[model samples]
Target: MTVERTLHHFPLDPASRQVRLALGEKRVAFHEVAERYWERRPELTRLNPSGMTPVLVETDGGKTLVVCESRAILEHLEEVTPEPELMGRDLAERAETRRLLQWFDRKFDYEVNGLLLHEKMEKRLLGLGAPDPANMRAGREALRAHLGYVEKLLTERDWLNGRRLSLADFAAAANFSVIDYFGDVPWTDFPAARTWYTKIKSRPCFRPLLTDRWPGLAPVAHYDDLDF
Candidate 1:
């Protein structure tokens, strides 16, 4: 029996990107549905009252499952497909991965993506007014600080959580890809972080995101450059 999977996501949304990468890493085939979630589409609101995106709808032999929220979707995928374990190998490693995943999903989102992406991507898509220079400035500063911390962490381990590649790496990479789409990342200044991201970008699972395009807006020139 072939299971059908559909993912409702926004092009520039980091959370949506995260779930996409997770599904790809798990080698799961899914149909993509571009969503204007901010428009409060009836079908979306019906599925998730929060009206948020990255919703995964899966239909197996006789069962249908709806998974809302990026983290939940990732966990569900991991539970269903345990090979190439992304969370980690042991309890402690899993805990660290979860902690870093939350940090990227929450703290990083609040500090950087919340401010930078809103001004750069969200407003443009939503037809909101102009981008606020002030917020962009603040977000850039936060990004620098965050990048510095990431570099520091990479000095000690191969991946964000530890020696193994995990969800933490994907979470951070998803957010970074969104910011990078606008050429917001200071890749030259953060060599270590750049090296880390270069590796992530080279992965087969990351290819789909590199090809993502918005109607009028295009990704930065180096956004998909593996050598970059």
Candidate 2:
């Protein structure tokens, strides 16, 4: 018996991207509904009263479950599909993975994506004027600090949490992918971070994202390049 699964997501959203990556890695079959969440659509609110993106809906045996928010969706996926575990093997590693996931989702997002994506991409999508130069400058500056922290972590461990690739890597890479789409990431200046990202970019799950094209805006030339 086949189940029906659907993911409502915003293409460039980092959290949304995380869910997509998790689904792809788990090899779960799902179709996507691209929602401009900023518009506050009725369909979005019906699934999640708060109207957040990356909502996952699963239907099986006449039962329907709606999972809202990226974190919950991720945990639900892990619970339903335990093989090829992405959280981690041990307690400590799982804790660390959650820690880094929070770091990127909350702290890094506030300092970087809030300024960069919201000021530029979000604004443009909403028919707002050009991005604020001040915001862009601040975003770039904060990005340096975040990338430096990631570089330090990579230097000590193979993956963000430890030896194995875990949810932490997907969380961090998801955020970086959005910035990379705009050519905002200066890879040359951050060699270690670049190398780490290259490994993630080569995965089969990442191919769909590489082909993502925003209406009037194209990604950077090397956005799809694995050797980049």
Candidate 3:
């Protein structure tokens, strides 16, 4: 049976970007519906009561499956399309992958994104006035700390989780990509993390994300540059 898949997501959303990277890496074809989740469109809310972006709707003939949120959508994709095996093959690898996923989704998000993204991107999108200077400073400091951790991890391993590329890499990349869009990432201060990002940025799965653009939010000149 052929499954018709549709992804309703916000282009600049980190969570949405994770799912997009996963789908692209897994080679799954799907239609996209760019949503303004803050407005809480009735159709979006009907699909997900929380009215979040990154909702996946898959229809196989008459049967339809609605997977809400990035985590759920990613897990669902892994189950249905297991060839690429993004989560991991072994227990240790899987555990590490899940751990890093949580780290990025929660810790990194709260510390870095909550300040930087909320001020730079969210405030602009919602017309909530200018970015807060104090918050931006704090966010930059936190980002450097996180990047230092990433640099340490890369020093001991090929990928974020282990030797092989996993969801952990995608998770971190997704978050950093959004931050890089605003030119806030201190790439020069972390050479290892920058090199790692360059590797992921050159991947075929990352192409779409490189082209992502929103009104009044222009990416840095090096945002899409693989060598930068």
* Candidate achieving the largest lDDT: 3
Model with the higher TM-score, candidate 1 or 3: 3
Per-residue lDDT for 1-228 in model 1, tens only?
888999999978899999988888888889999998989999998888899998999999889999999999999989887888999998988999999889998899999989999998888888898999999999999999999999999999999989899999999999999999999999899998999999999998999999999897888889889987
Model 2 off-target regions past 4 Å?
A: none
lDDT of each: 0.92, 0.92, 0.94
lDDT of 3 by residue, 1-228 (tens): 989999999999999999999999999999999999999999999999999988999999999999999889888888999979999889999999999999999999999999999999999889999999999999999999999999999999999998999999999999999999999898898888988999999999999999999989999999888887
Clash-forming residue pairs, model 3: none
Stretches of candidate 3 off by over 4 Å are none
True lDDT of residue 165, candidate 2: 91
Model 1 ranges with Cα > 4 A deviation: none
Please name the candidate that would achieve the greatest TM-score relative to the true structure.
Answer: 3
Q: Rank the candidates by TM-score, best first.
A: 3, 2, 1
lDDT for model 3: 0.94
Name the lDDT value of residue 171 in candidate 3: 96
